[model samples]
Target: MKVRLGFVANSLSLWDASPAKTITYKRYTELPKEERMDRLQEVTRLNLEHTKRILYLCAAHEIELYRLSSSLVPLATHPEVEWDFHTPFKKEWRELGDLIKKFGIRASFHPNQFTLFTSPRQHVTDNAVKDMVYHYRMLEYMGIEDHSVINIHIGGSYGDKEETLGRFHENLKVLPTHVKEIMTLENDDKTYTVEETLAVCQKENIPMVLDIHHHEANLSERPLEDYLEAIFATWEKRDLVPKIHISSPKSEKAFRSHADLVDAGFVEGFFKTLKTFDQDVDFMIEAKHKDLAMLKLIEDLSTIRGVKRISGGALEW
Candidate 1:
């Protein structure tokens, strides 16, 4: 069995290298008409450049999995500010895709919490579709549309879980089939449990991204071990390995919040459970410390009896 680990956007080791830099709509409205588009383009260019730097850093460290910042382009999905983010930056996007392909890295995007399908309003669903398209366009421009994934939660249960899930199914239809093929649903900490999210994934023929910490915080009636096989099975249609989100709690009082570094002790049982499956998986570290957290967790996990550090970010058992 093999497991590769990676961090989320914005490595703390890199100074001023956040790919999520953006101009607020308020700031954009205040700018002169001539400078508005230029400002958006300028921020986007910096973001693309920073993204390239992060990709190089990942390659240097042998990190094989990364989640791209969805905010790569300012006002990308805004109802009024949507502009051509692809035309002027073809070279930059291609460079990012090339780096990812050259390093054999598995890149992905996770849209924000608002980019969900279970909303009750038509405008909300429309915005959700727009947001998904925005994400899809980035991957399309990068020329990695087929190789990458975009993950989201099952969304809020509203007041009625059954009715909301039905709405979810109905609203999901708005997404284009091609984009939906690369979409994944994750178990959220507050509402959706592993069982529910896995069921949705199975129903939709999408992959499930098990968030171990969320599973811990939000208990399900069934044991996690019971869902292991089904969870792994969801990724069978996809070419990439199954992906999991790993994080630790901030405190007992704030159980749902992510800590700076993942505590090996907190995840030991989950790792043991996964070891029984005899499959390869990718761990996307969701800690506050970013890359440093990933490195620490790698070192921590490699100390287990059956695991060996195969590279800076990969382990074999």
Candidate 2:
């Protein structure tokens, strides 16, 4: 497989017009479901149009477009007047499938953030698992799962590391496995860096996603080399080595502002770091401006590698 650098779409597309300038999960959760659905409907229309526009922009600039999958769920939900367990989505699942098919680009969803397979809450894990199953099924309905798998946040850390690992392994054993080999686990900012994730991957035999921004925020305070060592340690023992999830050092500078790890300089450094490793890996750039950030980063990295390729250009999709 060729190396790829994509971007997470949610952060880039759904910006508020407010002065605060940061997206909040709470704000999204607080909106009425109806209202949320309505807004998402509008965003989908615009975003789909924008995707076409961006293809041209990227192609013109010699950039390659990679679409993250999670950003499409709201659009996947059937937007009907009412939603109930019987009709998880208001609209037909086929409708959602059609839209994704029409988009005709590479996209994948991240695993459920609110999903906890190990939650003590009797129904929490079950419902989350159902949603996850639906997502994969929907991807199949859309004909995307055969080629794409959604990214997932490895549930919560749950305080006890050993217990958490044990539960993850136990829980996964019972889950349905319908999607292709694209499903991947990412190291998050809150818990589990790449090295720790690597250990679990060794046990579970799953793919890895190294979120560089996450490592900087949580693990890089110690010597970066040690953290990198942690990443290398499990590659051989694990069935799949994670080299995806791209970013630069993240800052706790505020409850808000962060250094733009998606910048070209960081991509250069990341590519440099990768050059020393003797394996193939795929990376996704999760900068503040998903696609925009990735365009610049990949361009810079490719230039550094002395190769050249242009995207489909602004007019070609």
Candidate 3:
């Protein structure tokens, strides 16, 4: 079995290379009318440049999986703000896309927690669709819409799992079919268990991105091993390996929170279970330390007897 590792947005190795820089709407309004769009463009330009730098670093290190920051363009889906973010940055987007394709990188986006289709309010569902379009537009502009994916949680149970899940299917109709094709669902730490999430993914015919820490924090009645085959089955439609989220808990008291680095001991059993399956998988490290955590974990895991360091960010066992 082999696993390719990656990290979340922002690499600590680079100085001031955060791709999530933002300009608040209030700040935008404070600017003079003539300077409002210019300010937005300025921030976006810096963000795009920083994102390109991060992608270059990834390619140099052979890191194939990366999660793009959702805030690449500020106020992109806001109802009131209407500024062209594409035409001005066509070259930047194309360059980033080119780097990703050249390196065979698997770039993806995970919208904020509010981007969910299970909400009962029509406005909430509308906002969800709009937010999805915002992410999709970024991929489309980069010419990676066909290969990238957008991952989101199963969302709040809203006091009734059965009713809320049914509402999820009904509310999801608002999203376009093409957008839904690249969408994936994940199990949340508090609300949705792996069983519930897998059932929903099966019903919706969408892929599932399993979070190991979340499963440990909020466990279901059956063990995770029982659901592994079904969870992996969700990715059959997509011609890609199954992806999982990896993180260690902050502490016993704040168990659901992510720590700065993943504790190898905490995931040893999970790794053992994964080794039983003869398949390739991708892991997105969700620690607070970002790229540093991913590299550190790779070094720690390489010491194992049967594991071989195949690349800067991949291992085979």
lDDT of 1 by residue, 119-234 (tens): 89999889888888889999999889898999998789899999999999999998999999999999998899999999899999999999999999898899999998999999
Q: What is the C-alpha lDDT of each candidate?
A: 0.93, 0.53, 0.92
Model 3 spans > 4 angstroms off: none
Ranking by lDDT: 1, 3, 2
Q: Provide TM-scores for the models.
A: 0.99, 0.66, 0.99
lDDT of 2 by residue, 1-317 (tens): 23555555433433431111222345545778667655545544444444444434433444333543443334243333212222333343345444445544445566557755555565666665666775676566555576565666667767887787777766766567654245566677777766677667656655566776676666734544445555554444334434467766455464123345555665556556665654455566666666656656665666655434334211100
Model 1 residue runs over 4 Å out of place are none
Looking at model 2, which ten-residue stretch has the lowest summed lDDT?
15-24
Best by lDDT: 1
Instruction: Please give, for residues 1-317, the per-residue lDDT of candidate 3 as tens digits.
Output: 99999999899999999999999999988989999888889999999999999999998889999999999899888888957899999999998899889988999999999999888898989999999988998999899988889999978888998999999999998799989999999998998999999999999999999999999988999999999999999999988799999999999999999999999988878888999977788989999999999999988888888999999999999
Q: After superposition, how far is residue 212 of candidate 1 from its true place, in Å?
A: 0.5
Q: Which one wins by lDDT: 1 or 2?
A: 1
Question: What's the CA RMSD for each of the models?
Answer: 0.7, 7.0, 0.8
